[model samples]
Target: MDSTKEKIFRCAIDLFNDKGVSHVTLRDIAEKVGISIGNLAYHFKNKDYIIAEAFGRMEEEKMNILSGVQQIPSFENINNQVEPLLNISKKYRFFFLDTVQILKSYPAIKHKHQAYVENSIRYVKAVLDYSVGSGNMSPEPEDDKGLYWRVATTAWMHLYFWPAEVAIRGKSDPDIGEVKKMMWGVIKPYLTEKGIHNFETIKKEMYASA
Candidate 1:
């Protein structure tokens, strides 16, 4: 059973996803959750407070998923990590779909989100680093460390915003698997011959399964 706070958290996401963050009020959340405004205020008095809690849940889950992958990652391990976080993103679509204000309005959430972005970049680069060391990926040009981060950031951008991008495009939301393909494709250019074979084989499987 969801506690009152948990109930409010979900109700808040539903309202924010529908009416948007800017338009929702405390009373609206209380009404939806079948709680009085005074009762809801005990948990969260404002949108920023509620959203920070929700964002905390989302990031905690994402970090927990990333933590399971270990510091070293193979091509397939990297693909596996994306699905978990992407599902979390879909659940809290408003966070990505209508992000600017909520982040701006809540500096702590904004800062933590920035840290998550950095952590994701580090994770991807670590995978590439391991792949390069093991001869599964091409070496960075002149051993330039910046190159890895650039590639990682490109991949992260797609994972972070594919849903929001689709929303802006007025297109159907791509499935989590499709988003993974788009994400993997960003770094596909950096893979070695063996890595390419694995990438292609798995890509087809994901496409087929989806």
Candidate 2:
């Protein structure tokens, strides 16, 4: 990306995070980038174009984070996943916070976002499968093949909306620690004794490293 274009992209993200996406205009982004609207347009045709580019980068960023997951699941690996994932959400706060509006307003973005979300849910299910196969997590109960799918969907829901939930409550955005706790809470019931032990060990290491 050109340096100037990158500046405009970054400035737009920050403004969208500060003001809701619907509240921001191309002019706002241009001013924030210290460039004129015409120059900004030269880089991005319009707000929708900028949003499309932003989501494209977001997909790439998320893929990088998911690619770090190990073949064998462990609490430490889960920690590695959750922390950066939450950081991404924070960095692109408006995406989660204004998801409904964005989807409604941009048909192209909505289709892309839905596809990305399905891939993400599959990633979560894969982690669960690895954890179960490794004896860290219990098998899904009651012969329910859909158990993993439902759990993965629920986890994605929390991951997608937790930031928005916090913001709507007028609370300061949560740190990774808080978000991690909520994530673990979602999966904790399915953890085996070994899983619990691994979690505790990782918790100690995480704090020590911090």
Candidate 3:
């Protein structure tokens, strides 16, 4: 995309994240980009289009982050992944929250949101399968393995929603790390003895490097 269109999308994302789609006007986004409303409209026909494009951009960035991890992540690599996830949460928390809050107000967008959720589940499952195949995780029965994927994806989505509360409060919640640990607990029961040992070693290595 051209720089001008990129600037408009960035500005719109910021405004949507802060004030929400319903609360923000096209003029607000234009003012943010130091462009006339006409110029902004030249790139996007309407606010809905802009909102869709903003989310599309977010999805692109998410795919890039995931794709860059060339192998099953150890705890050290986990930290690198966490940084991008946290950055995304900080940047777009409000937009995500607002999208959920106004689901009834935009049925088309809501449908798209549902599709994205399903796609995310699939993407996460693929990653988990890759990790298990590479011996990062324990082998399990097919049924139980599917359940693990579901659990992980569900936990991840819940975590994404959490950042919205933090964004609204303008402070990091002290319990956030604990929440992450609890989510990890979902897979704890499924780990083999060797997997458990490896996980502990990985955690120790992660802490030592920290």
Q: What TM-score would each prediction reach against the true structure?
A: 0.91, 0.90, 0.78
- In each prediction, how many residue pairs overlap at the backbone (N, C-alpha, C within less than 3 A)? 0, 0, 0
Can you tell me which runs of candidate 1 are displaced by over 4 Å?
143-145
Q: Rank the candidates by lDDT, best first.
A: 2, 1, 3
Q: By summed lDDT, which 10 consecutive residues of candidate 2 come out lowest?
A: 66-75
| Tens-digit per-residue lDDT, 130-152, candidate 2 | 98998888999887878878887
lDDT, model 2: 0.83
Local lDDT at 205 for model 3: 47
What are the per-residue Cα lDDT tens digits for candidate 3 across 1-210? 559988998888878776778888989989999999999899997887886776666677766766554354453454357557667666766556776665676566688777767766665566556657767677657666467667668756655676766657776642444444554566567666656776786456445544
lDDT of 1 by residue, 33-97 (tens): 99999999899878878888888888888877776665537666777787777778888888887
**C-alpha lDDT values of all predictions:** 0.82, 0.83, 0.67
Candidate 2 regions exceeding 4 Å error are 70-72, 205-210
Every model: Cα RMSD to truth: 1.9, 2.3, 3.4
